[model samples]
Target chain A: MKKENISDAVIRRLPRYYRHLNELCSRGVVRISSHSLGQEMSITASQIRQDFSCFGEFGQQGYGYNVEELKAEIGHILGVDNDHHLIMIGVGNLGHALLQNFPFSQCGFTVDAAFDVSPAVIGTAVNGVPICSMSELDTFIQSHSVDVVVLTIPQTVAQDTADHLISLGVKGFWNFTNIELSSQVPDVQFENIHFADSLLTLSYRIANR
Target chain B: MKKENISDAVIRRLPRYYRHLNELCSRGVVRISSHSLGQEMSITASQIRQDFSCFGEFGQQGYGYNVEELKAEIGHILGVDNDHHLIMIGVGNLGHALLQNFPFSQCGFTVDAAFDVSPAVIGTAVNGVPICSMSELDTFIQSHSVDVVVLTIPQTVAQDTADHLISLGVKGFWNFTNIELSSQVPDVQFENIHFADSLLTLSYRIANR
Candidate 1:
């Protein structure tokens, strides 16, 4: 199926499917029926079938799905097989946290370098990746083929920074800036990190409960 | 409207509506048509109308929605009007980033205090909130009315920490532990923050493009 035809709801659920399948595979789960998979994920068995049907079939009538094979299939569809090159802009606390904590390489993204304007942080290194100055961003982008950029910059300069990166041939962005940069440039691919939205949803549950 | 009936899709969209309406209200855009709102958000106007309908009426036909009024309505529906007290566990890199950067007070959750195990960090102040020892968590929770707990702890100790807090009377959690804790406790509430999912989505976009 083409990307345009897939609903946002389906696209969003893709990662979860990939993650669940990965867990099952790691734990030596040979196979999983939609009903049991649904139980693990808290989704309905029919809904699980429907979500997977949007992509393609990986199961039979009563045979269920092979955990490793299904995971590999979903991984291919989600592009988890691609070794994406990433550069983090703004090496603040959040940047450091991501650099130190996130298993980017294991997940198929290699964070080659990080950039920042802070003099104290510019020369510093985290996880053996050199932190470059803001002035070197254009050079860095030119020298290395950067696929995705992680924006940890302040909101004031977020869009401008993104525009600069896009102009410099960056393909996509993993934005953490509080602003809505995705909407500004429709042609550019963006995955906005909106933490507050989750917090608000949690609040809604609390209030509703 | 009841919680169970409302689809997760619609509940997730409420934040976007709240955020967009907030921006519109801030920009002095008093009124907005569904069509314009849809265009701005990259959603269908009918979808926007349908999502809003899940809550309550905040607009009139042809007249459009009052941005400020609608924002306030959504804010209330999202429990943004309620003051939520938050206690952050593990004042590490991610924790510090959140405390220093995120606008918790502005978003209805006030981060009253933080906790850490390290001697170097304990008793330190981040954004005026004191970081106490992890041993004091029970006492702190007992003394204060903490509605939400921010778990920035390691995955190994995450569930145990959550269980400890729940026994201490905490109602909810905003989890970034990289492990699923919400499903373990069926009756409890949580919003898991997964940054890796966004990276995977970005990878998909890059590969597909």
Candidate 2:
């Protein structure tokens, strides 16, 4: 499928498909049909086919898709085929854990440095990624050419940190702050994962369901 | 508008609107039009109007919505106006920090208890919420009647944890694990936040844009 044709929703589901395929591959499953894949993903078979067809044909009439090849395709599409540099902001509890248990490296993105406002956390290393002061953000971004920033700062400071990163030419942000920053930066692609908002929405669904 | 008429996408965006309005209300902004709200959210004005219309008609012909009233209405729609009990599974770094920071109570969700397998973390309080053993999950959940669960377990254990929670009658899940479990539980609402996938998609968009 052409990258330009892929929707944001489809792109988000690619990693999901990749992770499931990895599990199936580990279990010695060689191939999977769109129907079964859809069943596993709780989506319709035709939806799976349509999503996959956006890039290129990968399924045969009866043979379905080769697990390993599909996995590789998704990995490449996600840019995990090439290692990307990551810099994390806010070495607080969540940030510290993220740095320690960094998952991107396994999927081809590595955290080279971390930044924080806490003096106690500075000069420390979580999973060998050294924590630096927030004052060094511009220098670090310039030196490392950090492509992605993992934001775990407080809600009040999220916008400022985002502005700083964007000023440094950072391409994308994984924002974990509860604050909504849709108006702060228009050019940068931001993925806001508000934990409280998610829980509240879920609660509402469960109560109303 | 009737709650049944609200789409999932619209429901998801309600929180974003709520956050934005809350910020505006705090800043003493009394009124906002659909155009201005859409501008702030990076969405179209008509789309914002449609979403709000699903809840109720709050805007006038020329005038928009009252900032404070809109914020409260959105909060009510999201079920964040009243306090709801919440439980956290996998009290690791992310969990601990989330407990410490993030005003869940202010948002009408409270982290009453946290569960983990580690004995060291058990019986301890991370930001006033008591850390409990995984063995106590059923008891705590049942007694507290927690409607929502915040999952931060490893991908390997996410499915099992979800299954266990579902079996206990938990209806809502905010899953942070990269692993997708859409097929594992069909009835309950599942919101998956894959940080890597978000970052990758954002990077791709930034690179292509």
Weakest lDDT window of 10 consecutive positions for candidate 2 chain A: A178-187
- Writing each residue's lDDT as its tens digit, candidate 1 over B1-209 gives 44457877788889989999989988989999999999999899999998888777778999999998899888888888789899999888899999999988767988889999999999889999999998898888888898999999999999888888777767799999988785354447988998878888777777766
lDDT (Cα, tens digit) per residue for candidate 1, span A1-209: 34556766777788898888878878889999999999988889998899889878889889899888888888888877778888999988899999999989867888899999999998889998899999988988899988889999888999888888887777698899888884354457988999989999998888887
What DockQ does each listed candidate score?
Answer: 0.75, 0.48
Model 1 misplaced regions, further than 4 Å: A1-4, A182-186, B1-4, B183-186
Worst 10 residues of 2 chain B by lDDT: B200-209
Off by over 4 Å in 2: A1-7, A17-29, A33-35, A44-64, A117-119, A133-138, A181-187, B1-6, B117-119, B133-139, B154-168, B181-187
* lDDT over C-alpha atoms for residue B172 of model 1: 94
> Considering every candidate listed, which one attains the maximal lDDT?
1
lDDT of 2 by residue, A14-117 (tens): 76787788888998999999889888767789988888887787888989999999988877766676677778888888887777665767667778888888
CA lDDT, every model vs. true structure:
0.86, 0.78
